[model samples]
Target: MTGDTVEAVSCTQLAYAFGETRAVDGLDLSVREGEVFGLLGPNGAGKTTAIRCITTLLPVPSGMVRVFGHDTARDRMAVRRLLGYVPQQLSADSGLTGRENVALFARVFDVARRERAARVAQALAAVGLTDAADRLAGTYSGGMVRRLELAQALVSAPRLLILDEPTIGLDPIARTGVWEHINAVRAATGMTVLVTTHYMDEADQYCDRVALMARGRIHSLGTPAELRQGLGERRRAAGTGATDTLPTLEDVFRDVAGSGLDDQSGDFRDVRSTRRTAKRVG
Candidate 1:
C-alpha cells in the first residue's frame, strides 16, 4: 500500500495521565489498513488506556492520535465514524433480545431508517446469531452474548473494529467461535481490526501483526512469525544453541516487555492505587 493510503490508526509519542499516574508513556504505533493488529499485554500495560485514547473515549493532546488521517482530538466525530469498539465489559443488555441489542447500536450509528433493519439482520447473521436473534440475551451463553456484541459493532459498518479483550471470560470453544466470526467479517470486509488481549496465544493465532506493550510503552512490534524469527536470530547470534525450539511469542514478550503487568482495573476502581501512584509522582 502507498504511504498516501492512510494508516488505520497511528500514535506518535502518545501519553496519558490518570492524576499523577502515567498510564501511557511516549507510545508510538501504527496499524496498517485491513490487518488484524493486536496490542497484546497483561492488565495495566496501558493497552486499554491507549485504546481509549484512539477511540476518543478519553481526551488526549491534539495530533497525538489519528484514525485514517483524521486527528482524534481535532476531528472526534469523524474518527468515531470510522471505528467500532467492544469493551471487556458485557455490552449486550441481558433484558433485551439479541436483535434488539444490535438494533440499538444500528440506531446509535444512524444507519438510515430505511437501512437499519436490514443492517441489523445482516450483522446478526454475520455472527451466527440468526437462530437465537429473538431470544433474550440473558438466556444466551457467555459466548453468544459476546457474539451479540460483535454483531452490534458490525451493524455500523465501521472501517476499524476495536475489541478490548474480546474473549476475556469465555471458554476455549467459545473464544474460538468469537474469533471465527471476527475472521469471517474481516475476510468479507477487509476491515482493519485493532484488538487488545492479555492472551498472547490468541494474538499469535489471529493477528497479522502485534505490539507488545508494558508500562505504557510498546517494546515489540511485528508480525507473529517475524517476531519469532527475529528472536531466534538474536538468540543464535548471542551463542545460544541453534537447536533450541523456535521461540514463541510468549518468549519474545517476556524478553521485551518483562513480567510486570498493570493489574489494576485502570479506571475508577483503581482510584486507591491511582492516588498512591499519583502521590508518589507529586
Candidate 2:
C-alpha cells in the first residue's frame, strides 16, 4: 500500500493460544489511519491478547499482525517505535512526579536526550497536565492520573496509540476528561487509536468504528449507528419489541455476545489482574 493508504493496524487471520485454550482465533481486523477504532468485548473475548500481539508484547504464534504495514513479528523494534501503548493496568509510579513519569517513557521510547524534556512538556500540555506536571502522581485525582498515563503514552509522539481500558475505573466526568485529551491529541497529530473497552457508550460516542468480539472472534463490525440499525431492523423483522426507539449500542452488544460471555470468560488470573487494575485506578 502507498503511504497515504497504509492501514494503521491490520490482523489477517490472527490467532493466539495458551496451551490448551485459544484466546484469539482467526481474527481479521483493519484499522484505518487517523480513526478511533474500538474493540468492544466482554472480559474474555481476547481483545487484550490481540492487542498484545499487535504491540509485539506477545509472539504472533499463528497468523499475521501488522502495524502501519510493518510486520510485528519481523520488525519488532520498528513497530515498537511506531506505537505507544497504555495497558489496562496502571503504569504510572506514585512516587514519581507527573513530568518524571512522562520523561521516563520518553527515555524508554528512545527520545533524543536533547528533545526529551520538550517532548515531555508537550505531552503533559496535550493532556492538560501542565499545571500538575510537578506534582507527585499519588497526589493527583483519579482523572488526573489517567491523563498522566495518557501523557506518558503521548511522550513518544507515536503514529498509533493503543489503549486497553484507558478509562476503565474513572467516574463519568473523569472519563469525559480523558477522552477529550485523547481526541485533542488525535486531532492535532492525526494519530490512529485502537482502544478496547467494555463501556459501549464510550465506544458509540467516541469511536469512528467498532468491532464486537466474542468467543475468540469478532461477531460484528461497523459504525455504532450502523450496527445498532442493523440489529433494530432484525428485531423489527422478527417482531421483537421497540420499533419506537432505535436500539442502543448496549443492546447490540447483548444481541451479539449475551450469555455466551460466561462460557468464554477469562480464567482466574485474568479476573485478578482486571480487578487489581480497577481497584488501583478507581
Candidate 3:
C-alpha cells in the first residue's frame, strides 16, 4: 500500500507461540483502508494465528497490533468494536433462528437496545437473510448458513471485516452468492476487508492486494498482477520459458511458499487453542 493511504490494520514485529511452537514470528504487515486484502497460504502457514492475534482473539503483547490506530493490547474493546470477524469454522448456532443469532451479536457489540432491532433487520437484509431470519439456522443450506454468519458480523457495522476462509466448503454457485453480498455491502459502506483464503482465483479476482505467507512470515506482497509479473521475471532469469500470459495467484503461492507447503508446520494450533480463541472473541 502507498504511504499516504490510511492503515486499517498494522502489525510490527508481531510474534505468537503455542508452547514451543512459534506460530507467528517477527511478522510486519499493513492493510490499507477500504481495501479487500487477501492473505494466502497453505494449511499451517500461520495465517489463522496471525489473524487471531490481530482480532484480539488471543492475548497479544503491547505495541504489536494496531487496528485503525487503536493499540489492540491497550484498547481491546475499542479495537474489537471497530472490527467484525467471521471465523473459518461454521459459527451459526443451529438451534437458534437467524434473527436470534444476529440479535445476540448486536448486544455483544453493545448496540443500543432500541436500535438493536433495526440494526439486526438491516444486517439480515444486507446478507439476503431477511426471508429466512425467522427460521432455525440449521434448516438453511450451506450457502445460507454462510450468509447468516455474514449477517452476524455485519450487525455491528464495523469498519474492518475480518473473514477467515469465508467461502470454504461451499459450491461455486454458493460462493458467488456469498461474495455478491459481501461486495454489495462493501460498495455501500466502504468497509475494509481482511480475508484469508485457500482459493487463489478468488483472491486474484476479488482482492486489491495479497500477501503470500508461510511459516509465520510474509514472502511476497503486491497486487495480483504485479506479483505475477515478478514471478515471470524470475522465471526468465532462471533460464525458463516466461509466458506473456499472466500467471495465476496459485503460481505465486507455490513459488513463494517454497518448501513450506510440503513440510510440517513449525507453527501449531490445536483444537483447544481454537476453542480458546472462539471463547475470547465471542
Query: Per-residue lDDT for 1-282 in model 3, tens only?
Result: 356666999998888888887788778899999999999876777898999999999978533888998888889999999999999777889899999999999999988999999999999998888899999987888778888989999999999999998887678988888889889989999999999987788999999999998877888999999999998888877867546666678788878775634544223323444454345324
Could you tell me how far off, in angstroms, the CA of residue 12 lies in candidate 2 after the best superposition? 0.8
Model 2: per-residue lDDT, tens digit, 5-73?
999999999999998779999999999999999999877789999999999999998999989999999
Q: Which candidate is the best by lDDT?
A: 2
Error of 1 at 168 (Å): 1.5
TM-score of 2: 0.93
| C-alpha positional error of residue 131 in candidate 2 after TM-score superposition, expressed in Å | 1.8
Point out where model 1 deviates above 4 Å: 239-243, 259-282
lDDT of 1 by residue, 1-282 (tens): 255878999999999989787889999999999999989865577888899999999999533898998999899999988889897666778889999999999988778999998999999999899999999887887678788999998899999999987886678998999999998888889999999876678989999999988788888889999999998989988977453778888788767665443345334334654454333222
Native-to-model Cα distance after best TM-score fit, residue 242 in candidate 1, in Å? 8.5
Full-model lDDT, candidate 1: 0.84
TM-score of each: 0.88, 0.93, 0.90
The models' CA-based lDDT, in order, is: 0.84, 0.90, 0.85
What is candidate 2's local distance difference test score? 0.90
Sort all candidates by TM-score, best to worst: 2, 3, 1
Runs with alpha carbons beyond 4 Å of true place in candidate 2: 1-4, 263-278
Better model by lDDT: candidate 1 vs candidate 2: 2
| lDDT-sorted candidate list, best first | 2, 3, 1
